[model samples]
Target: MSNVVVQPTGITAADVLAVARGTAKVVLDPATVAAMATSRAIVDRIEAAGRPVYGVSTGFGALANTFVAPERRAELQHALIRSHAAGVGAPMPREVVRAMMLLRVRSLALGRSGVRPLLAEALVDLLNHDVTPWVPEHGSLGASGDLAPLAHCALVLLGEGWVLGPAGERVPAAEALRGAGLTPVALAAKEGLALINGTDGMLGMLLLAIHDAAHLFTMADVTAALAIEAMLGSERPFLPELHAIRPHPGQAVSAANIHRLLQHSAVMDSHRDDLAHAVQDAYSMRCAPQVAGAARDTLAFVEQVAARELVSVVDNPVVLPDGRVESTGNFHGAPLGFAADFLAIAAAEVGAIAERRVDRLLDVTRSRDLPAFLSPDAGVNSGLMIAQYTAAGIVAENRRLAAPASVDSLPTSGMQEDHVSMGWAATRKLRTVLDNLTSLLAVELLAAVRGLQLRAPLTPSPAGRAAVAALRDAAGEPGPDVFLAPVMEAAREVVRDPALRTAIEREVGTLG
Candidate 1:
């Protein structure tokens, strides 16, 4: 990967992923340095005038009235970081920490946080050298800008906390810095607050979730198409004219994808004129587009939110270009919180509808002529019966997880920072919801492919056949009874696999 130059605008989700994965390097633009210098001058002028700024000369939170002497200004910054790095819980994933570091650096580079260019450089060096700080998962109320978690990150820059070395071993920050040929950065006025006061943690997770949801939403349509064909369902409902009348962009995209995936399908053509077949299929088959399309639309809205946030400068006591320092509440995480919560609900509904299709495929009565549980022999082998159970279990949990985290706020910071946005919690659970949705869709794919295989002599559509062939190659074709766990896991891998989608897209063009 090449170096990604940090600009005040145009940083993308892919860039964050690349930097987090250690495949890309970050370089600060000269204009960004110039901007930071201008902001730093304002901060310095403010300090020189001896007037109290929220985080410059005065204490923070409930103690904002307390003033510090000029001699202890640096000491105040140091103490703030130390006291705030008090989070508890398991260490956050390495990618999350790296993303947080990158986002913090990006926000500072925008020149609104009043930090020196060297501070931003230190953050970039941390990423380039693969030194990830051990940030905890808890202690952020999503107000006052992920204070505890970010302070832990700042601790590594100060050479005062633990860091994961390039070799993936936990080591002291001092040791890691020395081995990487770097040194600790000393805190200056407002530098500590600049380092810790932003919504980087929540925003990073939200971005990752948005990226994953985009893929999964498209995958949902693909899996639903496979299920529709497997159950011998008709594609008339997906006709262009039928959907054009109620044209929601997402619904139209989904209906078109299903239409394309089911084209030239012998099984569907065989039942097109048959009077014995039910006139209309169940809602699970007919309404797949409506449910999945709503999710696609939700994802589009969430992406917009994430895009706006990517270019925003979130900080407390932001420095103005006119040499004036003012306190602001841009650090609140409500925007991200609401978006995360909405996506979780949308993802859960997608999984719910997919689970319903899985149920239709497994039930012998509802599955047209397919065997019970899609098994070769019903009672002897419990083929995929429990798979639906697993999918159902996951969907149930997703429903619970979908409850909005933003609605439950608890006061923090001595009641000075009340009405916090539990966005960290929201995004954290959103990851789980996405993971569960992947598995749920995989179960649906497994059942549908088995149904299609049973439909044997009659061929499925080109795209559906390609998906089944890819799955069979990866996980082997389903049979009577065998070890179910590995097979199901392999199927899940195929469902989550980008290559499967790529192969199908090559055959029938790209899906929605």
Candidate 2:
């Protein structure tokens, strides 16, 4: 197994995905161990001196004023973990659970959490052994971190929770530990609090969403170019000088991709000087770059937020260099919540515009004289009429999912955490939006590919032809529509497959 070295300085988004996908092992650096030891000493000294540190000698949340006897400190920590492990709903996916575990390990390895190196090592062991805790879907308020979700993960380290066995069967954590040649370690003074106090759950989901969106956004550009050709839309709007004046980074890149994809197109050249067919195209065709470009810019902002979070130390009562433990609000999820919400809205717009293009490709009046619904026999075969309905349905759902989750706040912990980030919900909906966007783009691709075929001997540009040929291979030639669901699913797979992007890139270099 390839190793991802952990350090106090933290890791990247790609590294998080690698460990989550079970493609890499996690190892702590020697220097990181040394840094952890230095912070552990501070925690130990505070305990010895009987200081009422927030997560050490005193109780948590609203009970912080309550002090526990030193002899019962172990019980205090254990109770904290057991009580907080109250998540409800379906078990989270294996990759998401793995991602949460990996991110929590990174947070602890930063050394400010004051956890013993052994505690952090146990998390690494779970990741390397594929022993994932069965975390539930709900329970985070996104303030003071993703408490319940991380507590479920922390519970497994104490041999007191359920975990997915080697083959993904749910088993006792103790049994899983023994099967992996490992034993659960007891939590020390601040160890349990450290284990659960971070934004790992939402952050994990955000990183995974970013990874998937990168591919989806590129494919949107590809699908849009095909739709423009299918509709015989003018390529004049994508000219370099037109976008250069605006100077939005993503706009210029998107315009360049569309402009390059339409170059040398016999269809575009056939209508270049035809006054009859060459009035301004609809907004869906002419303004695709503007919409997609704005989404890309939003994604860039979300990436910046994720990058900052990856290196942060998000624990309460962090160990300071001067031998003091200070309580801080570093665990709040507001920053992540806002970013996730923004990205969700941006992605929904991308899908909305793509759906419009799909609708246009199916309408005879709008599709430049192509058969209605791209059907061989408009009335005999219902054709792709329902496919447009599917796209519209998905777009409606995307709009609902795009509502900002960051604006929501529910009080918890006896109203102690009165303003929560709702970031977990934000990231969750963002995933659904991206999923809908993929299907929405697939509908456009299916319609667009058929529209190109209807154009016949005019021939599309090299890049457009490459994309059309790839879709045709998966979905069959665009003739009479048969078994629409399977063909639509095939097109969805084509959108997801790297092969479509590979074919297009081969003809037009790399897309922006």
Candidate 3:
């Protein structure tokens, strides 16, 4: 089971992933609760003194300088949530929405947002009841936080918008909130900004995408091992001694992963004695560790960013216990925005090489001892030909998306909101790359496993065979080209399953 440790004031990306995977729970650290109390006391004192504050007595965003009539301030707060809930696009996946909810609530819990403990508690209640706000995917500037999207999240507190009720029924926000015995929260000073500002929505999704992409990196190694041994590719490139002299961690990790896959394999035995099938084979095979290691390095950098940020108090007008309000740039997402784009490039390369190997697996001229297309009929069936085509297309699309969204920024907020990161765009693209790469690897997994199927009853690498068996059990042998789309998706599920991967690793040992 997955779980997250909510320390007195810390939230980890792993914690979010655990809750996302249905393996754990989230609770406030006792210290965070105290911080909330302290901040709320400061806010109450300020409001009681009738001193005009930013969010408490003023408008937000474009209307920042406009003052809200004191008598109508509460009404303005409610209206802000409703008016800003203008997001349009397909609704985000339920898991992402759940993550957004937790992130937003946790951000507010730091007490810096000036929301009442009851408000934070209600968010917890909503999440516990499994009532997630149906937030739209588009409409974030990646600045002033993820305003429009989070407005959808805050809508649940207002008894507006749609929610996934405990019974799994989609119901009105009011019904879901009331049924859960939670009340709408009234935003206090900076509460509205705190509720909506920050990179929670994008960060949550990117964090999960990043974690999964890391797993995909390993899967790429396992699948690549099959292509290597089948093609009689040399394993000398992965020797630990080779990497030790250069000393790149990602390169080392990729080399290690391959070593794990090739352990106990007979296919590599003939590579030296056979006098060469096609000389040295393609760079994708010979340089798999090197190319893929660069990707691992990129992932490592991205992980560092997420690991550092998830526990940070990202929402702004961050509270100071001494009653000083210092506005800062904590809300900016340039760091994560750039990280998202970087990892997409890494993931794309991971897919790009896997696609090359799939091409190799399908070509009779290249795939030693294997039938054309890994199918008996070859010319008549076309077997895995189009699968390679599909992979190529997805890889190209990934290339286009890999252009950093963080590098290009459009000025907003009348130049006040200038220097936008568009980090949300980067994170969103990273997610798409993840999906694309999953299917790309799946196609290869299908072709490789199919190749392994022919060797059936013969044997695969101790680890490779088990990996193939797990897919075969779940997806069955690819007898005839029926509906392959489902098979591709199913194969992806097998690749994503951690247990199958662990079994392969245990049998094969470490890569390098």
User: Per-residue alpha-carbon lDDT of model 3 for 1-512, expressed as tens digits?
Assistant: 44454554667776786676584656766677777888878877777777666776777766768877767877887888888898887777878887887887668766676667667666777767777888877878788778888888888877789876555556788877777777777665566666787988888888889888888888888888777776667777778898898888888888888876776765555455666446666888878888788988888888888887767777766666788565667788898898998899889888999999999988888887778887766666767778788999998998998888888888876787877778888898899999888888888778877876665455567866786777775557645555567777788887777876877767766443
C-alpha lDDT of candidate 2 relative to the true structure: 0.89
lDDT scores for all predictions?
0.88, 0.89, 0.77
Give the poorly placed runs of model 3, Cα more than 4 Å off.
Answer: 1-5, 165-170, 277-279, 453-458, 473-483, 510-512
lDDT of 2 by residue, 1-512 (tens): 68899987998898998998758989999988988999999999999998687889989999999998899898999999999999998788888899999999889888898879999899999999888898988999898989999999999999989987656667999988898888988989999999898899999999999988888988888889999988888889999999999989888888888888888888888888887985788999999899899888889999999999999989998998788899989999999999999999999999999999999899988788989999878887777899999999999999999999989898888988889999999998999999899899999988988888889888988877876777675667656668888888888888888898888788779988
Candidate 1: tens digits of C-alpha lDDT, residues 1-512: 78878886637888888887658999998898889988998989889999988899999999999999999999999999999999887788888898899999889988898889999999999989888898878989899878999999999999998886556566899998998999999999999989999899998998888878988988888889889889888888889898789888899998898889888788788788888988898998898888888888898998888889888878988988777778888899999999999999999999999999999999888888899999988898898889899999999999999999999999976889988999889999999999999999889888888888889889988877877787776556657687778877888888777988898888889777
Where does model 2 exceed 4 Å of error? 165-169
* Candidate 1 accuracy as lDDT: 0.88
Write the candidate numbers in order of decreasing lDDT: 2, 1, 3
User: What range of 10 consecutive residues in model 2 has the weakest lDDT sum?
Assistant: 472-481
Best model number under lDDT: 2
TM-score, prediction 3: 0.93
